[model samples]
Target chain A: MLKNLAAKAIVPVGLTVTGFVIVCSILLYSYVKQDLVADSIQREVLLGDIIVKATRFSMLTDQRESLRQTINDIGEQKGVEHVRIFNKKGVIMFSSNDEEVNQLVDMSAPGCIECHSGPVTAVHLGPMDQARNFVNAQGEPVLAITTPIYNEPNCSNGGCHFHAPDEKILGTLDIGMSQAPLLKSLATLRVRLVIFCLMVLVLTVGGVIALLQRNVLLPVRQLVYFADQVSRGNLEINEPEGTEELVSLAGNFKRLARRNLEADDSLRDLQDKLDTLTRQIREREIGHKSGN
Target chain B: MGFLRNVRRPPDTPNRAETAAAPGRERIRRLHRLAYRGLWGMAAFLALSLVAFNHGWLLPPISDGARAVLGKAPPTNLISIALVVYSFSALVLILSRMSTGQGKYKGWSHLAYLGAFYVFYHYGNALDANFWAVFAAGLTIMALEHYQMWTFCTEAIRKEEERLAQAERLEKFKS
Candidate 1:
């Protein structure tokens, strides 16, 4: 059964298409996942930058209540997990979560690891040291982006602020965004892609099989039956009709059968003539003998 | 026993040319059978080579320079075109036979086989499964036609030889 042409054709085609689908799925999933994560990180970073800008005046004026109110309001927006401002010493100066305010953040935490673990001093934090992923206490995946607030000349020169000429990094603003909605949408997209690939595969295989049956297998079967009949000395077989190849073959077979039949008829005619001639000669010889 | 009787009663004269040409005719018939067999052998070889080339088992050693000269299309396209040309030639041969009613061979049938081979070899990669199915069907038909032609030729030759022998004997008896 495996040696059959249909099996041979279908198996290889099916395998190749399946391999293509799997490879496409892997590549597409990775690409979409990467794109979604990158986009999410960019949005969160922009939000953190805006929050840092908004709270800069409050922080410099020593209005702790205003800074706390801004953080809480921003965190109430959809998809924002939390918004916090951590001082240079990794102390949570203000937080949307009231309990987290006035607490000391770990140096190894997602918001602090970028500047603390590296050889570079925390005072010279760059944009690359601002993003990390971690699971929140609620067990949801979160992307945190940190924006560093730099000490400006005005803050140091102004009469209300203390005299510090070289305070480059004042603090970091960390924004944590929930990734649940994005992941759910990605899962839905993946399911749709799988369904599309499967549909394509089924349609392609079905069309191939249908064409094969029509143009190849069915005609071939008819020709075989005709050939069998001819083999049994039944010269009265009808020619098969289908593709050009099969039609030509059946036509040739019919002609060959006719030729064989004609050859047999001619041979029979010759044998009959020879037998009659032999009998006439024998009878003539017998009459001649009797007369003598 | 038949040979003894004919020798004892040698009644008629024989055509000297017919007697002399008998062996030559027999040789010609043998050569014709050999030619058919050789044609089939060549066809089989071509079929196998086509299959091997299509499946990548047989790769022609073409250097990068040669490939550059040949362009990007697969070399099998050239082979398919050649086969198509050969099939056309076969078509002409078959037409000639039909007009003359001389040769018993089915050149058109061979043309069909070659055409199918061209299709399978040229477009098989794109068509995939349909290629194998069509190839199998075409090959089977070609094989059957070959057998039928072989049987027909053999039978016709045998019958002709028998008729000639009987006619010669009758002529001898009458004369």
Candidate 2:
């Protein structure tokens, strides 16, 4: 894209046009990436904070429902795709986007395996990657973290994802935030990086081209002009003394001039000798004719 | 696939003889004037009528229905709209210049007017008033055709042509 003649022209001015575009692209990509990441992290942390707090409640009371509403409010933040709830047993309790999956999610397997069927951590799954641990229950760069909650009864009893008969322990509170926003942030970052790279590449290319055109091509063109002069018998034209390269060029021109001078001298001597012979021949012819 | 097969290939070189026989650029311009000016006038009229009928002929026609559907009507500063209009006019000027093949001086009084208007609207209360950015960074690219109208001054192009012609003529004469 930068290889156009317009880009070539700019080389003499400063950076090539192509170089300027590349630099702009790189800067744009970096800026997009930074903004996207920042937005995603903000949303994720907000969601996680709200979810972790909500989990502490045991009953399926209005308060528990309110927790979903609170998360829904937070979910509206830019870049947030969805908010979800999971029990310790890995059952999906409430989801902001999908209402059908009221089934039990198996949280038995450690890490992300228990609930997520896809390539474990690759997707945003598990109580952890969805943010099972971190400050405000939100994780860092890897995934959002949030505290898993079981009802007080379940907590007061032994350790389990749910409650027993008369063992009225509330379900484990798991908040699954949409990683889409985070991924989007990352994608934006990727684009920004690409733009940044393009900008740098362009600037570098422009700078290099500019230098080459000014310092190399212009001088070489001048040298060519002088060489043409030498070829046309005007060997008196002076060569540049800018560098060793120029010095060598001047030497070559000098040699060609000397050779031409030598050839001219030889031709002149031959012409003179021919004229003298002609005169002698004419004189002999005249003297012989008179005797006859 | 069918379209691809049916697509005709462009000739390697234009048929100069046929073009030479055709009417001049002025005739072409007259034809364009008849065709597009009428079409644009009609289209703009209809669009305005439809909008006015639905939401009254005035500024900020944020329909209640729209508000109901979107939760809130997407709010935009009216001054921004005026600025956009000015930028659009400048873009049109630029296009005119380009069509005449003499584009230059893209930033004209109209663009400044738009920015000033934008500031006038946004000035009193609070907020940043920067409409030049809209014209330069946004509208210029969108309305590339018009940018030339404002930028492509006739004198500039004529001078360039004169210089080029003189140099070529001088070179040939020397040769």
Candidate 3:
């Protein structure tokens, strides 16, 4: 098998491989890049879903402690790394584990001076963290979620609970989730992807090699077999289906073999004819001498 | 190239002169030459990993910059694949150069084994049936391979020769 592959791949198989390598390298390069980004984005989206669900549940319940606790429980899931919550003011009201959220935070402001729209960290969301914003720190990503605490309407009825109207600005909540486990899982996925890519390249190239192996090896072997028959002065072999080029080649080889055979036969026949003539002439000469 | 080209002809045939002068010896020479070329091509392919997988620090730095930009590197995917690809291409280049002269041997079946190996190696870890299967298949090809070559070198000459004669005669009649 090795020899056959070696033989067949030596020709078109090898060339195909070279072309495939060049072509696939470029393709795989781009694919790998897109694959990485897509993968990270997918992970982030999954975590984001987790945060949204936790926040939504807390909003329905109307309890800060329960909301914060629920988010914490979900963050500590087998794959969840960290979780944190922020209020409408962008204050880190509650955190999974990071103690940096003890300071005052305000999210009512417009854009993030650093990562206003995405995962980048540079904007100030708190008075204490005005220098360094509430971004991901030490492999732990803090997802800022802002929720409003409404004042009871009955208190503003001038009877039971509230005092004024908009003065019921309760508190803010913040949540941060560690990205380590998620990143780690993604790393594993990347390894698997690499392996899968390797397999694909290998199998595809291998299949090509297998095809050429038989195509080149078999026909050439047939040509050789045909040649061997003619080489020994045997001129009765039919040409193998060596295609136009090989068929023509076989035709030439056969012609040469037959020509050599005919030339040798003709020369032998001529030698015999000369020997008989010489014998007859010598006999006649000897007889005349004896009679004289 | 020498080894592949060499294998296309038998050692005893040496050259066309010998082919004309002594056909028997010529056949032997061609056989040897073909074997030699095949061997040489393999030798070159085996040497590819030495350069591609050298792991030298200067071999070519991967894009740490891409990692920083994307927040993560591609996890050795590109480098490992580049290595495998380089090796496969080396195999192709060496073989093609050697076998250019062989029209019959220029087809694809002979190369099937290499491609199979590439696939096998890729999934060997995942599938767990890699080396053994490859070895078995390779050994099978080896067993059945030269059986035909020897037969070709010895027996088929006479039949082909007769066809060649008739062909030449027809050509002469046409002219």
Candidate 4:
């Protein structure tokens, strides 16, 4: 059923082109998503780190009220879910919300699990590792970054503070941001990619099919008609138009037919000569018999 | 009994052409059938797998190893690796084409293509997307190419058979 040139050539090529486009689109979409999400994570990590740095002086000077107010102000920004500083013991020393000032955070929580789940706490973590994604109580997606506040010589040697230098991590500055914008961007990207994929499929598949029809199928059909005419004893045929290869084949076919025609004409002439000779010989034999 | 005794017996041995062509023809036929079946199977699987994975109807086993490896490497690196492997696979396929026999050394080509699948799977895991799209595309190309080659062989064999039949007919006419 699929033995025709169009079916044999166009179908497979069209399908392969479509598949190729789809595969490429999937990979491209994936790469784009990865890049965008990675950028978002990096941005959140950088913001969290900057907030920690800004609050360092306030913490060193024992300005808890000022630090709390600063956290509250940062948290109040659009898309900023919450900002807080928690001590090493998981106690919320200062938070944007006053009611959660001294609350103990669960060590097993999504944001804390990266560092605290291991047998030994991980002091250093990559930006991706430090970032966590979760849905908050309000059922909105939030991305949180936890930056560790490392103890430095200045903090221990400062005149107002008396902390041992042996203490490595003092606390963690955790920041949560609503992921509405990122999600929205990703959703838009997905829709765009799907549309682009469909567009590519149609264009490529249609192009392939059209090319095959013109360059392959049309010429093949012409040749088939030419061959049928020749088979039905119609030696004269118009040259089929087609690709170079097919046109060359038609040329060869036409030449063969011409040769056959020439051969047939010569054979007919020879047959006529032989018939005349035989008739002349028979007449001569009859005359000889009658004259004798 | 006299009529049965007068019955002439034909030769039991097959002709050289038949013997030579029979096995090769059968092999090509089998390959063509496989290609046809595999093409449809790949198409169906690709569609179902993509939809299933996308809708979370079919969840792959939870494995973080692929995720970790994919996350650490940039997309460029992953793509580069896939491209290198794909080039190697394409070279193998070309070499197979250059060889005299159809479907020769196909196992090596298959093995080479499997390397590409590994990269696809890694990316899929990392992105939580369906890798079957890539896999099925590759399989479809391979199967189609095989089908085309085998079809050509089938046509050649059919022509050869016709020529042999013509010769046999001429031989019978001479007697």
Stretches of model 3 off by over 4 angstroms after superposition: A1-80, A85-93, A98-174, A178-210, A242-244, A288-292, B1-175
Q: How many steric clashes between backbone atoms does each model show?
A: 1, 43, 86, 0
Provide the lowest-lDDT 10-residue window in model 2 chain B: B123-132
Fnat for every candidate: 0.00, 0.00, 0.00, 0.34
Across residues B107-161, which tens digit of lDDT does each residue of candidate 1 receive? 3456466555544444334223234323433343344344435544555676667
Best by TM-score, which number?
A: 4
What lDDT score goes with residue B39 in model 3? 40
- Candidate 1 chain B: worst-modelled 10 consecutive residues by lDDT: B126-135
For residue A86, give model 3's deviation from the true position in Å.
6.7
lDDT of 1 by residue, A1-292 (tens): 3447675456445544543454445445655765777777777777777787787788778788888888899999999898888888878888889898889989886657767776776665544457788898889988788888888887787777664878788777888888899989998988987788788778778877988899889999999999889867787667888999899998888788888988999999999999999999999999999999
TM-score for model 4? 0.70
Interface RMSD, model 1, angstroms:
15.8
How far off is residue A192 in model 3, in Å?
A: 5.1
**Winning candidate number (lDDT):** 4
**Candidate number that wins on DockQ, 1 or 3:** 3
What is the CAPRI rating of model 2's predicted complex? incorrect
Would you list the rank order by TM-score, best first? 4, 1, 3, 2
Model 2: per-residue lDDT, tens digit, B1-175? 7789889988787445334324434444443443343334334434433443333233354455855774632223454444445544544554455456653433334334534443353322212223222323233322343323323323344454555556556656766
**Highest DockQ scorer:** 4
